[model samples]
Structure formats: C-alpha cells, structure tokens
Target: AQPRRWPLEKHEYKRYGRQLIMPEVGLHGQLRLKNARVLIVGVGGLGCPAAAYLAGAGVGTLGLMDGDTVEESNLHRQIAHSTARVDMNKTQSAMEYLQSLNPHVNYNRHEFHLTPQKAIQIFEQYDLVLDCTDHPTSRYLISDACILTGKTLVSASALKTEGQLIVLNNPPRPPGDALGGPCYRCIFPKPPPAESVLSCGEGGILGPVVGVMGVLQALEAIKVLTARAQRPANGGDWSTNGATSEAAPKATLLMFSTYNTPQFRSVRLRSRRADCAACSAQSTISRQSLTSGSLDYVAFCGATAPINLL
Candidate 1:
C-alpha cells in the first residue's frame, strides 16, 4: 500500500526540518502525530509546558480547558502566556500560543472549569487526556472520567520542586478484570479536603520544575499514542528498569530538592477497594456513580479531610 501523503506545507517543512530528519519522527511519525488529538486540562505551570511541546510536536488537534484567567503571579511559571495576557482566560491564551506555534495544528479552547459531566463530554473526543491541574478534586475527576470513557490519560503533578507522571488506560483492561492495572481511584481512592495541603497560591513553586515534568507528560502521551512504549503492566505497574511483576500498580514518585538532586520512590497502589465507592460497584465505576458524594478521594489518599462536617 502506498504510504499516505502528509499534506505538508512549505512553512511546516522549514519549521520542523530538524525533527523531520529523525528516524523516529520522520514523515510517518510526524503525520501520525499531526493526525492525533490530545486534550489538556489546566493551563497553569504544568499545562503550559505540556501543551507547548505537544503543539510543537505536530499533534493535529489540541483542546485546552481552564476556567481561570491569567494572573500576575502566573507569569513565573505559566510560560505559554505573557505579561500582556494577564487577565485573559487561560484557555484563550494557550490556544493563541499553540496556534502560533503550529498553524497546522487545530486548537480548541474550553474556557470553563471542569465538571464531571464536562470532563466526560470533552474527553471522549480526544485520543489522550493530560491532567495538569493543581487541585486534587480536579485530578480525581479527570481520572475517573478518563477511566470511565476508556480514554488514555497522561497524569502529572508537581509542587515545590517535585513532580510525578503516569500513563493510564492506554491498553486499558476489560471492565471486570481484577488484575487490571489500578485506576487513579486505586492509587488515590478519594479527594482530599479543601485547604489541607497548601495551594500553589500559598506555597511557592519553582517554575522550571513544572516545565520538566510537563514535558515528560507530553512525551509519555506521544509514546502511548504512537505505540512507542508498552502499556503499563496490569495493576498499574511499570518499571524504568524493565522489571515486570504481578504486584499492585506502582507509581514512580520523584522528589527534587533545591540542590537539583532527585530522589525516586515507588508505591504499590492497591487494586479497587471492595468498599471503594468508585470502582467497587463494578470492575469500573459508572459515570453516574462518580458524584461528589460517591467517594472521598482526598481523605482516602490522606491528602485532606472530608469537606463535610462529619
């Protein structure tokens, strides 16, 4: 079969000439990337880097979601926007930057906060979803939506000088497999109570640290989309060292100190709790079952207290 021609324009060739020369990302990979669609939630420190890299890499469609507007404080880390863009909707600013980065890539903006319904609706249209939000509530919500929709989620988080990344549901399991890789709920079962952990607003963060992790998130998303990396082993377990096992899913958490040294630790995530309000009812939690009251993920992860007075 003749390889499909990539409708490349002159400017695209000139712009991506270096990348186009690489064996891994030659015309074929570029084309594949150009045809792919990725949804990114949040346009803060982390989302800025991830979205920029993905757009520059030739992802065909980019969807950005964020209800917040740019603020003066964001100038330190949210690199996609500028001092001029302060007070602009983050989604709008990000979309403009992405378009400027690659006109061949289509940019979609959702200038709205993510809700359970919104997460499911928009996420279903994309090949992959990127979580770059700082709030645990948003993270769990995005995770659950992705799991329920069977969409691949590239989840990343950062604070102070540390960050973490993971790929979920790339080669997702069938609904009832006990050994299936753990869902985000399996890793965090509930959302933390508000104000338990210091918000980025209260706690300062190093800008470049988020840049590093966000790029990694984009790289993982690309690897999953292009079949470059094997899906994480069942039970959410993966090893950079190539070790394989049947244990519970393990998350690689990396902590970075101001000295620039990074400490790596792994945690084996439990599979669904039989009592877990999210995944316990079925092999997978139904969309309707994911209401705010269905799970206390924040408390489950020991990140925060329940919001209720109880």
Candidate 2:
C-alpha cells in the first residue's frame, strides 16, 4: 500500500496549475514531490538549476551543500548566485535565491565541502541525492556514499558540449527485491586519470548544456519519487506510450552530445554487478567500513586531491 499523501492547499493548487494538468503528474505525483527531501551536493553548474526547479516544484525539504564561495566568473552558469552575493558561500547564495522562489520549502544549508567524513551523515537525512560536484574525488565520494547509505542518486556530468545523466541505486519496487539499478561503481569502477579530468572552470562549458542536464536531473528525481510501488526496479526506455507499459521504466544511460545530428541517445544499462565492491552481496563498503574510514575513494579514482577523510 502506498503511504498517505498530504493534501495540496488551495494556494498550492493555483500555483502549480500547469503541472497539475499533466496526466502523469496529477495531484498524487505533486503531493509526492511536496513530501520529498532532496540534497543537492554542489551549488554550481548543475546544482543551481536542479535546486531551482526542485524548489519551484515545491519539494518539501531542500538541502544545499557546497563549500565554495561564489565568484564573478560563475555568474553565467550558476544562476542561483547573484552579483551582490559574489564571494559569499555558494550554499548561502543559492539558499537566498531558493527561498525567494518558494518559501514553502524547508531549506537546510551545509556550508562545507562534501568530505567523506560528513557525506554519509548528511545523506542519511534526505530521501534522494543529486551529485553536481565537479571534482573527481568528490564525485567518487558522493557515489560511494550514496551506495553505502542506500539513497537514490541522480548524478549528472557536463563537459564542453556534452552531458551525461543516470539514475542510480534506486530502491526496488517490491520491498525486499534485489537492488533496482547499478550503483555508480558498476558503470565507473575507477575514475579517469587526474590529469585528464577537467572541470567546467578549466575546460569551459556551454551554459545550456549543463542547464539541460540539470533540468533532467530534477525530472528523473520526480519520476522516481512519484512512481507507483509496482514500477520496474530496472530502467526503461521512453516510448510513444510513455512509461505506463511494464517495460517502460528500466535503467538507461542518457548521453547528450550537442554537436551530434541527433543530440540525445538513451542506452539501456545492464543489471548490477555481483562483484561490485559497494553494492554487491559481498560488498566491502559497509557501515563498519564507513565508520572506520577504510575506503580510499580518492586514490581509487586516481584523484590527486588531499581528501584524507580517514
């Protein structure tokens, strides 16, 4: 049985009229969004737009986690920060804008870098997590932490004119079934060499590319949160019939190349790996591992950062 949903207020119904009219997202879906608790781990590029849309959609609890301060150069892509807020922590700046967009959302600010020491603790507070950080170390950390905590993860990456989106480790539709999708480790067991990793600041990015990916991140999160209890544990393809069919909602990887003739391609992904160190039957990443700080995600990812959470 699905849990009871809170009723929408008269003002809320009026506010979200356009969305409420959609057959896929009527009153029930909107209520699910309103009750969701989402944590955004970076307030730049991807996080800004994702947080903005989630707030506007009335996600009940929105958490902003980032340690960096806003810089003048970030104005183009980080829409949540303003000229007046330059040099302020990104979390604070984003929160200022988000609250203005929807005061109904309960905002939590984590004005610190997402270190492994705090990743699991903070992730436990949210039903879903968005990985918008650019650092290789941070990405691996977020991925591992989400798998460890069993939180649904919507992770996206944008570089130049290219963007990628995937939903990972969502809970199975039926309560005790195997994991619904692959964890980040199943796809990228090791991060790229540090020398080859270039952030948006270093390599430059088309604003619209990241914007598009960020918006899709929010859309995926909404779908996962509102989906029926019997929805497939795996990913599905987008069909003319939409995701109503049984085979419509399986795990798929989206690759967006703005330069290509057909810019978007969705490839169905395989099931979880039995040998995955994080989410497998004999997984090494456990609560004990986390508590002992035994995992070396930074080193495993070939990152050169000094992220010694242990």
Candidate 3:
C-alpha cells in the first residue's frame, strides 16, 4: 500500500486536526496544500486577508510583494497592518503578522514595486500568483507575466462597495494536455482607460467587501492547489468508489456588490483566443522579448493617477 500522503507529525496533526478530518481535505489534499508555493502581489486589502488565510492553512511557501509603506488610512481595510506598523513596509508588516499566525510556513518579503523587468523572473519562482494590487499597470503586468510563466493566477479587486474575482491559466488535466483555463488577457485584453479606473483609496471600499473577496481568493487558491482526487488500492471504480473526478477549472468573473441588497453575478468567460498576444502560439511575448524590454505593459494599459492613500 502507498504511504500516507500527508504523514502528519504529532504537532501537525494537533495544529490542523479539524482540517485534517474534513472529507474533502483528507490526507492527500492537505499534503498538496502543504507543498504549494503561492506568490501574492500587493499586501493591501485583498492581499492582507488572502495571505492571512493561506498562511493559516499551512501553504509551504508564501511570497509577499509590495512597494508601499503602511499608512494610518490603510487600517480600515488593510487588516494585516497595525497602528504600530505604520510607516513600515507593507510586505514586512504583513509578514510579521502572518508569521505570528503560523510560523511553520516560510515567508518571503519583496520590498519593492513589481516592474515588468522583474515580474517574470520573480513570478517564475512560484507555483501560483495572486493579483491583489489596485493599479491597472500592476494588473496588466501581473497578468502578462503569469501568462508567460505558465502559472495559474487568482486575481481579485475591490472598490467602493463591490469586488471582482477570477482564476486564470490553470494547468490542464492530464498535465500536458491543453491549457486548462483562459488567462487574464483572454477576458480583458485591454485595461480600462486611466481616468476610468477607480481604487479603494479613491472610491472608498467597504472593509468587509474586500475581506470577503480576499477570503474567496484564498478559497480559490486552496481549491486549485488541492482538488486532485485520489483512489485507494482496492481497484474500485473511481465513480463507485466515491472519488469523483474534479471538474476542469474554468475562467469565470465573479461580481459581488454589498450595496443595500447584497448581490453576486458569476459569468463564464470566453476561452483562450488564438490571437492573444501573451499566450498564443504566434505571440510576440517571449523570454527573450521580455528580457530585452520589448513589452510596454504600463503604456499599453494607459496612464493612471498615482495611488494616494491619504
């Protein structure tokens, strides 16, 4: 018989006892989550909650990247930062809180802006990417880099009383089959015009709206990393053995509104486009092209006002 997938040490069993007993997250699934590596961009509203849960769940490696420093104003929605951490780097602040929550996980602090030149190199080191930044430039930059690196991306955003979420570029089943899900470029090939974009700082996001979406982002990440079904050695039929095949990950847009009447709308997105510049066979973006400074994601996405947290 195969060895137990997640051979929980005594401390691990004690720490994750509740989760380990869940039917969906039995030994195998928990092991997958433990070995997963996730890179989260921006330690603001979305990143804060998402990171907190992912850390609490015992993901093996968590990479936190942010260029901003904590501000008094960020406390309302950026839950990871505290009064004492004001003026501290956002990545460092979040890391400090997350380590306190679960020191068993490894945390990486990237204390700078995620420029196109550095995006691919950094992205390549992680198994998955989460887009938590509030700027259009960073959105396009993260999406394109994920496409180039073949990493699945769980992207979410919140503004005012609403939030949006999506999963992109999941690995196809059977491994080398076909690309599983559409990438970010597959849905919004172009970013919104500079003046049309709004962020939490400018539009005033509801604290709970971002918190819910961030938790959902973490949920999606867990689903992606740990949904593989395993079978026992009794040679039973997969279906009859109570091990149903997992559904293929789809590209969908989740729109959530917390106005007077809370509402949600999930729309299935289109499949990968053959002409997509980032993930297509004839695409112009490549490792060489990226290294040579050929992609102008910031300009392509249009110029936006500098984010102000005041």
lDDT scores in order = 0.72, 0.81, 0.81
Root-mean-square deviation of every model = 5.3, 4.3, 4.8
Model 2 TM: 0.88
> Per-residue alpha-carbon lDDT of model 3 for 26-85, expressed as tens digits?
777788888889999989999999999999888999999988999999999889999999
Lowest summed lDDT over 10 consecutive residues: which window, candidate 2? Answer: 171-180
Worst 10 residues of 1 by lDDT: 301-310
How many clashes show up in model 3? 0
lDDT of 2 by residue, 255-279 (tens): 9999997999988886676677777
Error of 2 at 91 (Å): 0.8
lDDT of candidate 1? 0.72
**Candidate 2, clashing residue pairs?**
234-250, 234-251, 235-249, 235-250, 235-251, 236-249, 236-250
Query: Using Cα atoms with residue i matched to residue i, what is each candidate's TM-score against the true structure?
Result: 0.79, 0.88, 0.88
| Cα error, candidate 3, residue 230 (Å) | 7.7
Which TM-score value belongs to model 1? 0.79
Which pairs clash in model 3?
none
